[model samples]
Target: MKKLFILFIFLLVCNLQSYSQIIFENGYFINENNQKINCLIENQDWKNNPTGFNYKLDGNQNILAADIKTIKEFGVNGQSKFVRALVKIDRSTTKIETMSREKNPEFNDEKLFLKVLIEGNATLYLYDDGNLRSFFYKNNDSEIKQLVYKMYLVGNYSIAKNNYFREQLFIDFKCETISQKEYENLAYEKKALEKFFIKYNKCNDPNFVSNETKKKKDLFNLTIRPRLNSTSFSTNNSMSDTFDIKFDSNTNVSLGVETEFIFSFNKNKWSIIVEPTYQYYKTEKTKESSVYLGGEVIGKVDYKSIELPIGLRHYFFLNDGFKIFANASFVFDFSSQSKIKFTRNDGSEANSLDIKSGTGFGIGAGCKLKDKYSLEFRYLTGRNLLSNYVTWKSSFATASLILGYSFF
Candidate 1:
């Protein structure tokens, strides 16, 4: 749960919101520590959770959000009395990126109900089905106090790292009144509501608002990457029996697709991109035969990899739909090695998991064209993604031409 807040920011930046705006009502202050804590009362932010208020308040009635609202009613005594309210809309908002021009955006809509009455120096109210809800004199929002409650209900889903802290957002609601009791209920209601949202929101996702919203905003995205990746396997020769081996480094070249999601912060000049893809890579390595084969040369190195490229790219725009960029890619390699031919009697050549994590850095230059496309040339070098007994240095370099599509 706590981890969700951290992931919210990363996922929120993935897309640029094209159309999304929340409707907000009057804002007010919630007295705390002899000071006023100002916040929005009735605001419509994105509600990611499905189980929340239906965005509608009966016209005859009113809805007060986390902030405050005041209403007046004439009592039988002919004196003007006040009906104050405090409404709590408990819902989780998924990641929300303000409307932008680039990607699809979503909004969360929620509605709540409000009503109230005053009595003595306290306020009394109905909590659904006429259940008694009370607030005493000392319960004023200005005073400090603590009261133990019942079972805590967790109604929110964990924030996904990819969802951004944009999810599970909240605001406070309050109302002032001429009726002391009404004010009392309003005060305590506001306090409880605020506490609920804050305590829960923070208890689960500490980064929800603090660190998730501020991130590199991507206004334009371009990805045109064609990768030639292949995997090969070797078996049945060294062990003098039967086995399988897959190596992509030396013997295969399969055309694979590479996709990229890019984000820009400094007016589209500086950006970061995540290229998550499945690539087929081929490699050629010299294999020495042990006592099994006496001494022999291997034919191919083939393997498949799910490559996640985290890149930092800087772009320079020229006149008329033209741009230049120099970017570095850090590759996280997840690969499987098997399905090729290997020694039959060799113990090392037996079935094995070739899982490895390697980091590769690549620098590339790209041009943004009129067709909303990009062409890039890059040189990548890094530690090998393969793990082997012999000296097969991961340090390798490659020059590639990439084509990309720009989305804005």
Candidate 2:
């Protein structure tokens, strides 16, 4: 039945040019251009016509053709490879189909399996009579043959083509059946996508170099320097030491300690510092113009004052948790006490007192430690006015050392 069916298809193709033509036998006469002809008896011995002839089939009839010509056909139904052609004299298809008939005693029914491709890899599956199965063998012609062999073969005949094909097919659909151009283009598209992804966000790209990583860094800081105090004063300018009344600042020891606070934001560091101090002073001197043993002498005066220092600080980090800093400040002093007393040769005692505020500038440098601590030394110079020169001018300066901490 299949051969007869195939033959019929062939004849239809042979006589297609003649729309009204009929074929007589698998190897009989064919009419071109629908032309009517004289009667020729069927099965008449020695009755062959004058035209060149061969017989093929058309429906239930036979095709008798006068000439044989060649043609080439491409994939039919988009699956099988066909570099050869079917006769087009009649301009019709001679379709080919394969199926296992249960009615045929030799029916060894096999099914086509499926497969799918992903990221350059293959996934295989087995199908049986429109259903899935476990037993499959390899066959270059079909996927079922391939899967079966892969499931049971011990030889090279079980190549993964079935597996490869199974991967190409999926869900009762045959994608591998598409033309070769489309398949190659699909693979090319995936490759391009991979390259694009790797270029944009891949960590391993050779050209992707940056210092913009989030990481902890050792940073420079700023701090206050400790304060030091000393005093020097002279009174009553004289040409000779023999005649003089002189009193000088004494016990001029400043009390000092450094206090600092630091802060950090992003890559910048800032600091605030203050060094407050106090000093105690006492002195007495007499100037002589002697008018014969008549003399007046004064007792020492006690003086004390508090100094307030405030400054702004800045720093830059170098390395190894080290930093350099500079600072500037203003100083103010408020005297708490001052008193003086004097006695005369005529039996008289006198008293005098003086006190006032002083102002100044402070400058310094220091190093930062551990991102939190720092130490520094700085010089402070400022003006002071007290007792209207009875204490002389309060011009004094000091160097100090300090320690500080940060909270950032």
Candidate 3:
């Protein structure tokens, strides 16, 4: 167990360092001279709009950085695209505590790299800086501009929205097939706006090309895990030393079904996991009694429980088929018909204590192959099985070697 733990720590450090390296993908950047240069650009799978990027020329080991000031445009082929545009943007605070009472938006002139969501006759763009989200648009042969939307405080407790973006869309991109009711119901969000722009563009020109990045639909997964558990248990009575006993560590097999939910952003590197497992521990020890006058006592534990571990996981992608992951979980255990029994050498029961449920924590590191097979090393902290008793105490710890197969 100690050797396996050390090996897990060594692999964890190596994988963490590997995750620190930049991931460069095939992309192109247009310079101020209107010349397009194909190169390898660092792809962070950015959740917010990036101000600058790092790139390397073909066959060059040295990397270079560029921002909106020098680069006119840049794109990771078939993944995402951005263009530098000088436009009017609203920098208003939408928080209710600090919202401006005025209904109209206060616009500021800024240069930003707008992410293209739709790219036909009528194009839609987005600028997000983690805290604020602003959308932009432009038609063929027209200057790009911000779609105005704002939130304001109404009396002391009321709030309202300035939905001027809807009116702007009605006036500029109105089509015979789109009705006024559609415009009124359209939400000021990325997916809603992107869908609306795509529909309008295709309505106007049947040959319109949709350039938006399609998000993945499979965000949840189910996995079956079978584990070999090395478990140890000990108990002591507060008033007597004869009740203290350390049972030998025992090994057992258990099964778990894991449900995982993957987040959409950050290249799908983060996830939430919930695993329900069944585990058991049984061991016996014979000790010479000090108080029983040369008589022997037999101590036995027959413990069985269902363990639920809910946790967060992070993945470091090594390639398309391999990845390493780490996770931490809080475990809640439930046991039924479980107890610790103490008996005399003559086969008469001396004492019996009912086992109670407990809570503990666990940490694990693992590697996955082809998104289907996985192996993990996990250690759970000591849990008190005598929690229901004030005078009796017990500690139970487990180390697991788990094998997983994903059905997803």
Index of the highest-TM-score prediction: 3
lDDT of 2 by residue, 1-408 (tens): 223323443454344334322212112221444332322212211111111233333343443433322212111111111121111111111121222212212223421212111111121222222222232222223333222111222244331211232333222222333445433343212233233223332223345422221344434323332333334333231343322333543333455544656443313445566656666666666645343246445445566777777877665545546655566778777778664444445546543435564677766665666667766555556354343644244343444444555544
What order do you get sorting by TM-score, best first?
A: 3, 1, 2
Q: What are the Cα lDDT values of the candidates?
A: 0.38, 0.39, 0.88
Clashes of each: 76, 41, 0
Q: Score every model by TM-score.
A: 0.37, 0.34, 0.91
In TM-score terms, candidate 3 sits at 0.91
Off by over 4 Å in 1: 1-218, 222-224, 228-266, 282-295, 337-355, 387-397
- RMSD, every candidate, angstroms: 19.7, 41.4, 2.5
Show the colliding residue pairs in model 3. Answer: none
What ranking emerges by lDDT with the best candidate at the front? 3, 2, 1
Error of 2 at 355 (Å): 1.0
Q: Which 10-residue window of candidate 2 scores lowest in summed lDDT? A: 85-94
lDDT of 3 by residue, 8-95 (tens): 7557856775674467999999999999999999887778999999999999989999999999999998889999999988888888
Instruction: Decide which is better by TM-score, 2 or 3.
Output: 3
* CA lDDT, candidate 1, residue 313: 70
